[model samples]
Target: MAFREYKIGTRMFGIALGGSMMITLYMPSLTIYSVGVTETGLVKGLSYGHNSGFSYEDPFLQGKGKPLTVTIKKDPVTGADIDPVDAYVYVPGTPFPSAVRNPGILGTEVAALSADDGQVGVATSDEGAVFLVSRGDYEGETFPYIENASATRDWTAAAVLASAADTDKRHVGSGKTMFVREGCEVSYAAS
Candidate 1:
């Protein structure tokens, strides 16, 4: 007599063929069956057994759009506990292509990270927006996050105040006089 094993998913079963008898067994929780065979290889046995096992849906093939969230955080001092600040966020108006508004979405907003403490959160809205942040000496730079959807240039100021509340940390000079080389205008919402 010889035995063969077959596996499907996590279950295994065995089949045995003898001179005139055929036995089938399911394992781990073995169930046995006996049958009589003719010379022609035809076997008489129970037609249907237990079920073919459980059916499962493919997990990777489903879902669409699926909302996303992102958060960004920073700390100037290593150990001292400091409240997280809300950075700037802005999205430009839709652009016109050949004098027509394209069918894309755009938006921008600034929010603090959740209490759980994380870096950045990217959320999906029906609208798409470019998020921008200003830091160090480049604080004055300002431009729409999504500049007309197509323009990659960011219009920014030449200097930024490291700490707006402290005069000593100003990015331009050491308690020094400076020139305002032409005036520039920027529109942004402060948190």
Candidate 2:
């Protein structure tokens, strides 16, 4: 007894069946979030008990155990990256917790950052945080949390988990397949 109204500009195109027009529509959304630093020249690895590494895991997609292919945006956003220093908090006034934990996405999340090029992966988890302050001197001093982090200083990205269907490949019978293709560029955070 309840009907949902489609928004204007909504693409409703599909095959005609049973003397009636059958239309299918898919709505996909992308989220970009940022890991901002409050102070300049702040030490990168303060939360993870280190001074030289950064890493995080998406809690939502832990069990899937699939790696996501991340690509940084060609043009970095302004104020997207920040320099690290030894401070009580990365964001001014927001004191660092005794321990920092990675808060992952709700539906699907990133598991880990790949060693090469820093692409994220998905995996299994009982209750771990999605993002985490990494360990080691290489990532801590060399890498920024966001893409082109050192240059841009800010890291923002779209959630890229391979577990999600990147493309639509549904077969509705009748020698025809129905699917919705989704595309997104890897950024630092969800907006």
Candidate 3:
């Protein structure tokens, strides 16, 4: 329910989601694909050891997988994009951000609920922390445990193993845990 500026060594022991949360992503360099035509977008490979890289799998899509088509939003609330072809997170609907262990929304949960409104600040390149996902209520989401880690640091053996475990339980349709982390992103997508 609170937003903190992600720094290296920021403790993300348990967030709403147990995988990578969205970090601040610049729209121009990033690329994101929309899910089901306008519902939401997923970042590829965001699960670190689990997802396909910056992209995350949507648990509600009948099966587990991320979006396949690139999308950009023109709505001012989502932000303005110089290039229409790019999946720009700064623009509110862009995608393909830097892959980290437990990806957290780029900023506060409210920003996340609406989309990464760049509340923290704009990035020249992909920057910030990856909030770890845990199966507890974090701003109202649930799943695995992903630690907020440094962008440059490599994942520890334990972290990687933990991520794999979370991925397994998270993608299941019944619980729909991934939504804990993705709830806001999906909400923004719907807008």
Candidate 4:
């Protein structure tokens, strides 16, 4: 088996939590390949199995000897680059679940989305609990959903989401945000 690896170094600038901040992300992964890699950007590596893997977005298929660089823009609302509070990277040949989003289906829970359109959803066990999803790409950024303030509980879920209503639940895209309220049970899934 041929071992192909990719290393990505990224720098971000924007406003987060009402302050200017800069962040850097180091990402590396290995894959089994014969040749060729093209697309390059920050992606949530998904679709992992023995001898192969896939990303939510198309993986850069450029051949070896290429350097991948990415620049994260500022949040539209806050006008500052969001911080990647819970970014993660894989070691090339790791086993992971798919990051695709299916409506009303349960998926693996991750800290953040690695690629754009990485599917994510929320579930709640508590009654009257609601989650708000922000409409934006939240990959390489940190947007935590506060479960309880009095008890001081936090979840590494997505950020800046639309409110998930008791009657209607929806899936959010990668780099988005979510907030839970009213003691509702909330869980996230990715394809």
The top-ranked prediction according to TM-score is: 3
lDDT of each: 0.19, 0.23, 0.28, 0.22
RMSD in Å for all candidates: 28.5, 21.6, 22.7, 21.6
Question: Any runs in candidate 2 off by more than 4 Å, and if so which?
Answer: 1-67, 78-152, 159-191
lDDT of 2 by residue, 40-127 (tens): 2112222222111112422342212211222222223342333431111122121222223332321111112222232222211222
> Which has the better lDDT: candidate 1, or candidate 3?
3
Can you write out model 1's per-residue Cα lDDT over 1-191, one digit (the tens) per residue? Answer: 66654355225232223312332223311221122111111100000001111212212311111111111132222223345332221212211111012111111111111101111232212232222221211135322221211112221111111222331221111111122112221111110
Per-residue error at 88 for model 3, in Å? 21
TM-score of each: 0.14, 0.16, 0.19, 0.17
Q: Lowest summed-lDDT stretch of 10 residues in model 2?
A: 171-180
Judge candidate 4 at residue 72 and give its lDDT.
Answer: 19
Better of 1 and 2 by lDDT: 2
Whole-model lDDT for model 3 versus the true structure?
0.28
**Prediction 3 TM-score vs. true:** 0.19
Give the distance in Å from residue 152's predicted Cα in candidate 3 to where it truly belongs.
6.7
Regions more than 4 Å wrong, model 3: 1-60, 66-130, 133-153, 156-168, 172-191
